[model samples]
Target: MSALDKALNYSKKVGINECEIVFIKKKTTTARITDSRIVEIKHNFDEDYGIRVIHEKKIASVRTTKPQEIEKTIDLALKSASGVRPRNFWRGLPENIASNQLSGVYDEKLHKISAKETMDIAQIMINSAENSKINTITGSLNIVSENFTIVNSNGLNVEDNATYISGIINAESEQSTIPVSGIGHVSSRTLKSFSPEQIGNEAQIMCTKSINPQKVDSGKYSIIFEPYSVGELLAFVVASNFNFKTFTEKKSCFSNNFQEEIAVNQLNLIDDPHIPEGLGTKSFDDEGIKTQKIKLIENGIFKNTFSNLFDSYKEGKYSTGNAIRIGSPMGRSSEPIPSCAPHNIKINSGDRSQEEMIKNTSNGLLVGRLWYTYAVNPIKGDFSCTARSGIRIIKDGRIIGPGKSVRIIHSLPKMLKNISEIGNDQRNVIQWASLPSITPSIKVEEITVNSI
Candidate 1:
């Protein structure tokens, strides 16, 4: 019998009410870039196991790097459970999970890629960003392939194979009047779709364009946020308000506004697990529940919230298959307990182009990237972020020149209501150790910025 089978059998023999096991086997390759060159390449393989045991309705979890220590891990978990509080609302684990193989989430080439080839890919990123105006290029390329398995006492056993590749390049220029920088990034599940060239070229373009930036005045103006900045906002400010746990506890900003119109009629936000080549694409959640597309917002109205088995059961509902054990370098982890998280938060495409949005603006700033983004007050939907680079000042329907750094303090509810346009240039975005989002340029009006 396999380790999972043996662990489960042993758990029942030990008088455990229920048990669950998660195993993760991962291979990671990373290429670090610095000083306009490939600096280092590293490869690692790891196996991790997580054991969860329930004794007398109380739950406890333990994690171990040694699979042979699973029995000991289970014992530790059971002993830990003795002093823990019981979840009387817990309905137990699901039985006999069914899932379909998702497309565009796995690639044979990435799964078997060598360290030499990874360095070659990193070199491509460096070469593409090479420019006379660019003085430095720094970034990282990460490729990961992982096997994830879950087994529970309720006869649920399932496994999946997934691969991911992501690259980013930051180009800095000293040739400019003031030192300026730009960034480029792309992520994919397939090798064929990954674009190192685009990453470098974009960084170079942004850096070169940001020469001699003009100062931004402290005033209210329209702002067009690019995909990367939008993703940052989504990850740090907006995504959590839709969490079922947050909503039920009245901690969400929109807790009392459910089923009400929250944004403009043109907006639609969805948690989609089935998008092609999406980094978060998967057939099942970490808890062995089948995944599905959920519309968090539709036609300007709040629609639904996502949850895992534990959160859903607490509210007398079923799981929405949003449980995730986020791993480092990019994939699922062998966490004994999973948390509620979206698979892929996506803003459905709109018909307007970014160029059109820029042209229509009377006075605005085109923000390409954001830094130090966070929620100042999550319950009030207040957020703050700094526009550091790739900022262009627009006047009279034209981009006159690059702009200097500015700090924005805004309300999320107000921003949503003031959205003027949504761009069609959707791109996949994943922040380091953060959420994965698919977004485009989102234009909002009457936002105030303080010169920094």
Candidate 2:
């Protein structure tokens, strides 16, 4: 019998009321580059199982990699469940099992990529930076192939295959007395969608432009946030405010603003799990619930929130198929308990081009990336972040010169309402395993930038 079958049968023998087992096998290959050369190449293969047992509305979980020890793990879970209070709002696992497929989620080329191929890609990126006169280049290339299977006693059996390729390139120019760095990154589900040369070139350009910096007075000014910067802000400050659990508990910024205009009329956001080449694309969630496209914000109005089974049960609502095993800084793990998270956050493109937004700005700061961003007061939508690199000052509808690092303290809802222009150059971005977003450059008026 298969491992899943064995686990389920053993659960039945133990007289468990309900059981679910998630089996995941993954292969990862990584190449690291430093000083414009390949520094290390590593490969890893991992397999793990996460088991959940429910007895009389009491739920317990266990995770292990050893197949022979699954029974012991299950027993331990049962023991744990016996000591815990029953969940009053516990709802049964999903019962419907259907066949579904997502396009561009699995690619044979990415799964079959070898160490040499990854090294070659790294070399190409390094060469591109070097060609642009960058003094140093550091980056990493990661390729992953994962097999996920979910089986539960409620007649749910599902399996999926997925592949991911991601790369980041950072360039530094030694010509300057103070070191300045630029970063470029690409994340995709297919191999052909990545462009190492483009990543390298963009980093090189940013590094070159940031050779010498000027300081600006601390004041409110127009700010143009590039896609990557917007992604960082969304990941750290805005994303969690839409959680159903948090909203229902009155802990989110949007708790009292549902169905209200929280942003400008041009702003629309969607959580889509079926976008082609999206890094988070999947047919179903971790709980074996079918995934669907959800409109979180429509024409500036807060529309809907995402939820997992537990949260849905608590709210007396159906699952939105947003159950996700929280991943680490590197990527997704198979051992963690499921929670609600967005799949691929797509911000609808606007009519204005990036060039037009820049040309029309009379006075503003152009930010290519943001770092060390976090919510200072999530309930109040207040946040702080640093413009670490690729910051340029715009004057009279033209870029004057690069600017020094600055800190921004702002409010999320107010900033969303202050959006004056949005660019059409939308790009896919993944920030430290936190958020997978497709966004475009945006210009927000009267943001507070402080000199530090």
Candidate 3:
């Protein structure tokens, strides 16, 4: 029997009214860079199945690596649900939703991307940097083979599979303007399908920019956030904001601001998992819900919030198919029941050039990325973070010098209102996050920049 069939038949047999199965399999390899060369490599392969059952107002989750364990797990799930307290706002499970067949996000050739291919690319990066006075090179490649099956007790079944190839490169330079920069990224379900030369050149440029970073006095200024740097902010947004649960819990700033034109009426933020070959691409979500593109911010106005099956049932809204289960082998958690979260949050890019935006600034900071950011209040959108790689710029378009641990304390809505410009430059970033969030570089006029 198929995974969906297994989940459905088991739920009925166990006297449980509703159930869902999330089945996933993955294979991957990763390599690290040290002393300007690869010093380590690791390979991993994992396969597992999890069942979540909601019966008689209670929910139970169980998982097993071996198929033999599925029956026991199902039995345990039903028994556990029976004895447990009813859910806080218990509602019946959902029917399996169907989705439009989309292309460009899955690859049939991902497994063919060999270890030899990655090793060759790593060598090229090292050689290029060494030739440019960038005496050292450090980087990594992550490739994965993933298959997923989502099924529910309701008439729902999904079969999805894809491959992913991604690379992260970091390089340091002898100059100071851009001392340490080299954020490289490419994702597709296929091997060697991304541009090595394009990403390589990016790393080279960022390293060069930081080599001799300029510095200016700390104060209010116009700030231009590069694409990779903005990605850090997107990660935070996906993690804390835009969730219907968070909104109901009074933990989201966008809750009260819905339909309000908060930004420049030109900016939009969208979460999309349907892009072909995208690392976050999927045909169905954790709840066996079909997925689609969702606009969180439309023309600078806050749009509707996202609700998963269970959450929507409680919130009295239709599901938006934004059910993401993070951190455990492609959404398979052996121990914890997965919660619905966002997959890809992208800030629509604006039309201004990076240089033009910089020149428009009389005095301000130019941030490469945000680091160590934390929320003071998700409802109010207050955040505090340090500038990771950047310079303080003055009116004449001159960057003064590189900054050290510069701090920025600001509010999200206020910052959006300060949108003086958004650059045409964009990038896909995977920072130190649970999952990478896609974003574009942006600029806001007169954000209070301070470091004493």
Off by over 4 Å in 3: 2-7, 99-101, 173-182, 188-193, 212-215, 327-336, 390-394, 398-401
Ranking of predictions according to TM-score: 1, 2, 3
Global lDDT of each candidate: 0.93, 0.87, 0.68
Instruction: Show the lowest summed lDDT stretch of 10 residues, model 1.
Output: 93-102
lDDT of 2 by residue, 253-299 (tens): 88999999999999998998999988778899988999999999999
Clashing pairs for model 2 are none
In candidate 3 the C-alpha lDDT for residue 416 amounts to 83
| Quality of model 2 by C-alpha lDDT | 0.87
Write the residue-wise lDDT of candidate 3 on 330-395 in tens digits: 323333366776667777778888778777777766776677777777678998777755443446
Q: Judged by lDDT against the true structure, how good is candidate 3? A: 0.68
What TM-score does candidate 1 reach?
A: 0.99
- For residues 43-86, write the lDDT of model 1, one tens digit per residue: 99999998888778899999999778888888899989999999
Q: Rank the candidates by lDDT, best first.
A: 1, 2, 3
TM value for model 2 = 0.98
